[model samples]
Target: MTDTIFSARQRLSANMRWMRFIVLALAVFFLYSLAQDGFSGRDNVESMTDHLIVLFFCCLHIVFYIVFDRSKVLEFDAGFLYVKSKNGEEKVALSSIHIIRLSSIRLGYIRLWELVYLDEMNNSKSVSFQPLDRQVFSRFQEMVKIANPVVQINRFRFL
Candidate 1:
């Protein structure tokens, strides 16, 4: 098997990190401001509504970050696949992959691709990224065919 490194688009990844950080900081600042007000009744309904809206957005960002933005490295080499994430690193054999799903997800204003697959242990794992190399899909199809011909592949776009 050829040694290939498939990484997330660096610019998009960095932007995502920055956005998450800013949202979290804003949430903290909002909380501090609310505390200074002694949690009083909504004397100013408009101001209270605006604060709630910001808090709602901050919560959504945290949920998405935990569920999707985890993968760090995706490397396929020597018939094995290496996935490194914030949680940990897992090495899986290509033959163990049964199904592959490629889909797009829209987060706020940006659209990113998600790669999901089922492993031998029957666990569904996914990585959200935009390929730095355009040949990534072709290389993946070629490798999957050679390693496991019966692997089911599906592609979809969510607009």
Candidate 2:
């Protein structure tokens, strides 16, 4: 059997749970403050509105990360690509992948990179992580080209 050629590990899964907890706690605290203070004056209403906006963005941020957080490890061998996570591991034949999309999103100071592909059964699977190396995508693209010349690799960035 051929040795493992490339491996990409999950970046945010390790600390994402804590992040969610902290953000939720802050949301609860802000809501509590707004309720206790009571909306009476114009200044108070403005302050409460600001808090509400912040809370809205906080919830959206957590949801975005959670939705994209799926795989724990992605490994490539000579003929197959393996995706491992809490549920289990899936082995995908190289030729079975038709489209590979790589996208990066920036939120404030944090940036996340995601890899999405269609499986053999035409199911879309995504793995979100910040690659340790900037060249990881290039290297991965090169490997995919060797395995399946027809594979479509798309890369884009978002804010």
Candidate 3:
């Protein structure tokens, strides 16, 4: 069988959902601050910091959304699965994959679903892949099964 390249769509979807939730919460907080102090005149650094923080979060969410949304496909070639990020590329190898663990806590958290990849021969190359949904996770698992059937998958009750 041919090798499977796993995408990060599931993880991105979960991240996007949480980002939306955070944005909504921030909007409520902004409104609450406006209602309490009025936007007429505020020269306090704390208030400025709050606004800055919210802006910073919004920008970060936007950037993350764009990158994840754009990278719909991941390519697996030879021993590596290529990760295309906004900044550059990251290659993860099958031999480097040490453990695949399913998380129970923070069910919808973006990075909760993790596949820990470790390279004992090269300490600097250890990495992890966090795919958000069952479909993608399963696909990845299947790929790993095909690539290396001996690899262990750790399943635990999520809290």
Candidate 4:
């Protein structure tokens, strides 16, 4: 029963983010050009600074994104959920799951899945995931039910 896999990854609104960055960079560049000083050498310096600023921000955004999202590799196998990330890897037996919740929506998919369960330490732990596809999303729900039929699963239906 270990069929869960990621069909997609990365942000669904990835295009939108790049679009915003492009627009912002263009606007900043135009402003810098308008404020160019009398000395040609100074003007060149201003332009270079503007370019550097844009590159700095764009690289910063990418770096932050990689650092945050690169941590987690999620999988499901034999009624257990495996989470391998920068922090650490932990497995959760489906039978131990007490709650399943899907929160937020984007492009016809769930943005977040919250699972609350007791881990091997018997301490309540909650894990949240951004499911990659509808099939994976539905399959996880079905798995939870198969593992513990009485478990509470709260799903959303949009008209």
Candidate 5:
């Protein structure tokens, strides 16, 4: 079998979108404060503090986007499943996955949760990852089915 790699662009979650909005609001407030003070001609201390606070919040928002906004794709090839990220990659042997759980959220979103067998300590470990689109999830499910037909998948419940 040939090894394959799949890559997809990640998007911010709904929760992150709200966070970005809050950051934008804070930036606007900071600008308004500066404008009210006649382009910051006076109140040097207050202006500096306001500008610093705005800068910190803007940095926080940017950091969050960098960490979570990228999409990840699952690759199954040559008896291995690889989870790749911008920083690094993780690989799990197909046979080592004890369980493959499928869960859905808000109607259309599918999350894949894997319970993997740790070879070093002979213990089980759980990990979860989300695909960029429903089609990707479907492809993942199909690949898992073909590779490990009897793998048990726990249904995810939300409440």
Candidate 6:
């Protein structure tokens, strides 16, 4: 029996847009204030520190969400990987794939797996998601090799 390479049942990329928007709002609010009044006086300095603290906590929340907010994954028994994300659902056939480009995308301190598949139509589709389990990601990598031996694997690094 062929095992599932990758599977996600819940919306992994869902709620991401809202989180980013919240962070952006915090930045905009504080940045405009900073521009209006230059850093001066003890009271202004104290107020700026308080706002900075709020910003730091907001960023921390995002980091926690990225690391712990995992999705549910069952199986892809149909020989197709079913993806349900913020962008909706899509299924890519294993056999119709000509290339599987592997990469990573980062939002804040977290990193997600990026898969770009070249389908039979010569079109490329990309999926960015965190696997339900780390073991699943390793298994998926091996499965990619078995499915498309000539697939291009990119080694991603953060400096």
Which candidate's TM-score is highest? Answer: 1
- After TM-score superposition, the amount by which residue 60's alpha carbon in candidate 6 deviates from its true location, in angstroms, is 18
Model 2, 9-31: lDDT tens per residue? 32222224345466566656766
- lDDT of the structure predicted as candidate 5: 0.53
Residue 61, model 3: lDDT of: 57
Residue-level lDDT of model 6, residues 72-151, one tens digit each, is 22233234556654445566665444443334456566666556765557687665555455565555556656776776
> 37-139, model 5: which lDDT tens digit per residue?
6564776777678767766766665665553444344555545566555556667666666666554433244344444444436667654455445565556
Clashes of each: 0, 0, 2, 1, 1, 0
Estimate every model's Cα lDDT from 0 to 1. Answer: 0.59, 0.59, 0.54, 0.61, 0.53, 0.52
Lowest summed lDDT over 10 consecutive residues: which window, candidate 3? 8-17
Model number with the top lDDT = 4
Report the lDDT tens digits of candidate 4 across residue range 1-159: 223343222121112222345545655654455445323455476667765765676566555455445435567665677766657778778799888776553424426666788999999987666666566667767777888998877776230
- How close to the true structure is residue 78 of candidate 4, measured as C-alpha lDDT? 52
* Model 1, C-alpha of 8: deviation from truth (Å): 18
Candidate 5 segments whose C-alpha is farther than 4 A from its true place: 1-56, 69-72, 99-128, 133-136, 145-152
Per-residue lDDT tens digits of candidate 3, residues 1-159? Answer: 332333332232232333445555665665565555546577798877876766666566565555444432344544556555555666667666666666553524444444566544565432333454666557667677777777778776342
| Model 6 C-alpha lDDT versus the unseen true structure | 0.52
- For candidate 1, the clash count comes to 0
RMSD of each: 5.1, 5.1, 7.3, 8.3, 7.8, 7.5
- For the record, the alpha-carbon RMSD of candidate 5 to the native fold, in angstroms, is 7.8
Query: Residue-wise lDDT of candidate 1 within 1-159, one digit each (tens)?
Result: 123343321121222443546656666775677565546556687867777776676676577555444535666654766666667767777777666655556656554555556666778876665444556646765676688888866656622
